[model samples]
Target: MEFDGKTFLTALGLAFILEGLPYFLLAERMPTVLRFLSERPAPELRRLGLTAILAGLAVVALVRW
Candidate 1:
């Protein structure tokens, strides 16, 4: 499929909304959650991040296929 600026922008906007939703809905608990994450080991965080990246890529690949 051809690249489209509007579709790209829409996807980015949706990502932003999803990223912000947790913070907006759980404003009070966010600080504690952030602190918990901050205290996690670097290796663990890296693994979690890598997992998320792979999961997102898999979803995109499935959608494109």
Candidate 2:
């Protein structure tokens, strides 16, 4: 329950790396991938976002437990 600044920052930095890797590694395909995502309906995007959040939470819970 206590705040740990270093651990928090490390996790945040890892998240940034994970989020940026696809765009950095797939420089060419990113435009097409982004175009496909842009065309998705709002509800669909919301569902996908929720699914990702839940999955990420599950992993974090397992790791921290």
Candidate 3:
């Protein structure tokens, strides 16, 4: 498939909106949630992050297929 700048930008913008939505809607609880995450062990955080990455990749692959 050809590279499409517009599509890329649109996806990036959507991602930013999704990323910010929780903070915007849960402004009060976010700090507590963040603190909890911060206290987690490094390996636990890495495993969580890796899971998210794999899930994202699977979604993208399925969408593009």
Candidate 4:
């Protein structure tokens, strides 16, 4: 699939809204993301993975928005 810059950004913004929606509605049963962040003993791998996720999301958001 190929999308121009603006189309890519709109799709990305929708994705973030969708992903964050579940967590917003299910705060009591937080996703692994939340749990890992709260854990005092989080592993290095977990931090790296989370950083990648956030960075990727940021790029998509900026590009598409």
Candidate 5:
């Protein structure tokens, strides 16, 4: 995807925020998710991460186009 200066900056800023969400959202449950990952591997984590990536991409796409 492409982006202008402001779009890229905004997407980058939002990405920084989103990257911190699980920590904020699952304060006490953080270990649970970590342990779950240790016991069972799944693609959901990757997909969830990709969702944010796609969100940034979409923002850039919209802003630049």
Candidate 6:
């Protein structure tokens, strides 16, 4: 699938909206979540981030295919 500038921007905007929704709705719980994340080991956080990236890539690949 080929991407155009507009499509890329739209996807980025949508991602931003989805990412922000939790913080917007759960403003009170954000600090607790942040604290929990802060306490996690760096390696664990790195693995978690890598997993998220892989999951996102899988979804995008499926959708694009």
| Candidate with best TM-score | 2
Tens digits of lDDT, candidate 6, 1-65: 67699988999999999999989999999999999999999999999999999999999999989
| Candidate 2 structure lDDT | 0.98
lDDT of each: 0.97, 0.98, 0.97, 0.81, 0.82, 0.96
Ranking by TM-score: 2, 3, 6, 1, 5, 4
Q: For candidate 3, write residues 1-65 as lDDT tens digits.
A: 79999999999999999999999999999999999999999999999999999999999999989
Q: Give the TM-scores of the predictions, in the order they appear.
A: 0.86, 0.93, 0.90, 0.42, 0.51, 0.89
Candidate 4, superposed: residue stretches over 4 Å from native: 1-3, 31-65
TM-score of model 1 vs. true structure: 0.86
Q: How well is each residue in 1-65 modelled by candidate 4, as lDDT tens digits?
A: 77589977997899899889878888777867677666656587688789989998899799879
Cα RMSD, each candidate:
1.4, 0.8, 1.1, 7.6, 4.1, 1.5
Steric clash pairs (candidate 2): none
By the lDDT metric, which is better: model 2 or model 6? 2
Q: For candidate 5, list the clashing residue pairs, or say none.
A: none
Q: How accurate is candidate 5 locally (lDDT)?
A: 0.82
Comparing 4 with 6 on TM-score, the higher-scoring candidate is 6
Greater-TM-score candidate between 1 and 3: 3
Q: Count the backbone clashes (under 3 Å) in each candidate.
A: 0, 0, 0, 1, 0, 0
10 residues in a row with least lDDT, candidate 5:
36-45
Model 3 TM-score, all chains together: 0.90
Encode model 5's per-residue lDDT on 1-65: one tens digit a residue: 66589977997798789879999988899899788877754687787779977997898799879
Q: For candidate 5, what is the TM-score?
A: 0.51
